[model samples]
Target: MDRANIIHDLLDWIETHLDQPLLLDNVAAKSGYSKWHLQRMFRSTTGHALGSYIRERRLSQAAQALRSTPRSILDIALQFHFDSQPSFSRAFKKQFGKTPAVYRRTPAQGMTEASPQSSAQQPNYHNESPNLHLLYNGKCTDGKCTQWMGQR
Candidate 1:
């Protein structure tokens, strides 16, 4: 694939796996490229480092979830692979200039709510699935666990 196609595929993969614990190695493996090469190409094509792109995307998704879902801030933070609520809040404020709670209370004008069909299309993490594993403190715990994991 060409550079643009590769980058597009990488982005799609990132979007599909946002709810999971994404790591550079995993992304590289999925893309069939070495980590260093993928990082360089991703940065050149997207004008952001691979890690930054992932972080920004996660924050964007978290922002959307904050506006659309009734889930708690900490739950949302953990769902997005953030280490803690404070760290998530710091990053959210840095990106959106408001905390998650404030954003949930008074979302910006352009914030769009996901339609029922779109929401229904999302994967249900609570469902029993062997391929999906919940990680806590770097260890895969029970499938039903929702404890905090370290940074992605």
Candidate 2:
């Protein structure tokens, strides 16, 4: 019915099937919006494009796999659908400023917080994260404020 609903529906599908192929048209169709309209809505409301959102989400999952599993960098990269190590490495470096090796060796250290400003949130956002709780317990009571769920 609205931009938030559109984005929420898209993200719900994303979370459930991160490993599956995603198409903008499919997402748009699911949300009952045109592809272009959904793209514009995502950019206007979230300030990041859908492609970037999917990439970030994939990277976040890759980082999590690196930390939680004994998998190698290549394995993690492949797990997130990245075709090659260099491509994955470049993206990982660009977003996180570290390679998979360094990140896996120490996930909590050398970590940078996603400023309330940037589109990047911490990559460790599995179900148990406090952020998930925030999403569940918080709401925009006024419907106009852009504040986060728990923030005042």
Best candidate per TM-score, number? 1
Which runs of model 1 end up more than 4 angstroms from their true locations? Answer: 110-152
> In model 1, which residue pairs have backbone atoms overlapping below 3 Å?
none
User: What stretches of model 2 exceed 4 Å from their correct place?
Assistant: 110-152
Q: What lDDT score goes with residue 43 in model 1?
A: 70
Shift of residue 32 alpha carbon in model 1, Å? 1.4
On lDDT, the candidate that comes out on top is 1
Write candidate 2's Cα lDDT for 1-152 as tens digits.
Answer: 55565565566577656666667777778778788987887677544577766776677677777776787888778777787999999888776667878767864754433211123432122221213211211111222213323322
lDDT of 1: 0.65
* CA-lDDT, candidates in order: 0.65, 0.59
TM-score (all chains, Cα) for each model: 0.71, 0.69
